[model samples]
Target: MKKRAAFLIGTGCVLIAVSASLAVNNQLESLKAEKSAELLTEAFISRTTVFETSVTEMTNEPVPEIIADNEIRGADEQASAKKPIIIDGQEFIGLLSIPSLGVSLPVNNDISYPLLKMTPCRYFGSVDSDSLIIAAHNYNSHFGKIGMLKPGDRVNFTNAGGLIETYAIAEVLTLPGDAVDEMIKPEGWALTLFTCTYSGTERITVRCVKEERI
Candidate 1:
């Protein structure tokens, strides 16, 4: 009986140590994500400012009538272009903001294991196409609390070209991690944000639709 008690105490100590170590590691990851987010936000803002300045100067210059007409014709195409914003040697597509969650993070142009560690990445589709899907790790500084969002919550995405698209949450549901086809299927959702559940077995999916501007 005494030997069994000692063994039980030893196992308890091991479990406690493992739990503490995991907590520390999680905290460190969150800190890293926060720093990366700050850097990306600054870069995005700088790029937008420069683009706006150039546009202002161009508009100020006198233009030929025919040239002005051509520019007007291509305006829609230019606005829909997904220009890559490079920061720290990584290509970011734009900034994603969830006002209800008070979360804003730069989304990379492509999704991968390494990139997800730094910030959210575009899992599929484009913002202009109205089928954007984003994925990120469940770090507290990332999409950890997205599951708390409700229908009608506001989410915004600012593209590299300085256009901001607003979306309203339409639904929140869980999908199996292997449901890749369903996750990317437009299905009338203008935007979809997803993160792994706390157990890492399923995805917490937030479906959003474009919010009509008054």
Candidate 2:
């Protein structure tokens, strides 16, 4: 009986140690994500400033004559216009802001495990198509608090071209992590934001629609 008690105690200690270690590791990861997001936001701001300046200078120059219909841009050229903005060796499509959650982060053009650790990434569509989907880790400084947002809350996406699109939260739901088809469906939503639940078994999905401006 004494031997059994000692064995149980040892197991309890091991469990406690593991739990503590995991908590510490999670905190460190959250901090790292927050720092990365801050740096990316700064870079985005600087890039936007330069772009605006360039546009201003071009406005002073004479406008080029329009080409004939047959000489218009090809499909391939039109697609190239939607390419992601490359910044510091990373491809970013835009910046995402959830005013209700007090969250703003740079959005990468593609999603990967490593990229999610740095900032939110485009999970599905494009801003121009009005079917954008974004995914991010559930770090406290990231999309962790997105679930707190309520219907009618404001969300905004500023594309690389400096076009700001506003959206109003329409719905919030949870779907299984494997519900890829359902999550990416663009039939109704203009923008979708999702993050894994704390348990990582499910996703917290937020759906938003474009807010018409007067």
Count clashing pairs, candidate 2. Answer: 0
lDDT of 2 by residue, 27-136 (tens): 99999999999998878767762233222211222212221121365776445435667888999887787766667788998789999999999889877687899999
For each of the candidates, give the backbone clash count: 0, 0
On a 0 to 100 scale, what is the lDDT of residue 46 in model 1?
A: 83
Query: Which of the numbered candidates is closest to the native, going by highest lDDT?
Result: 1
Q: RMSD per prediction, one decimal?
A: 6.8, 7.4
What are the lDDT scores of the predictions, listed in order?
0.78, 0.77
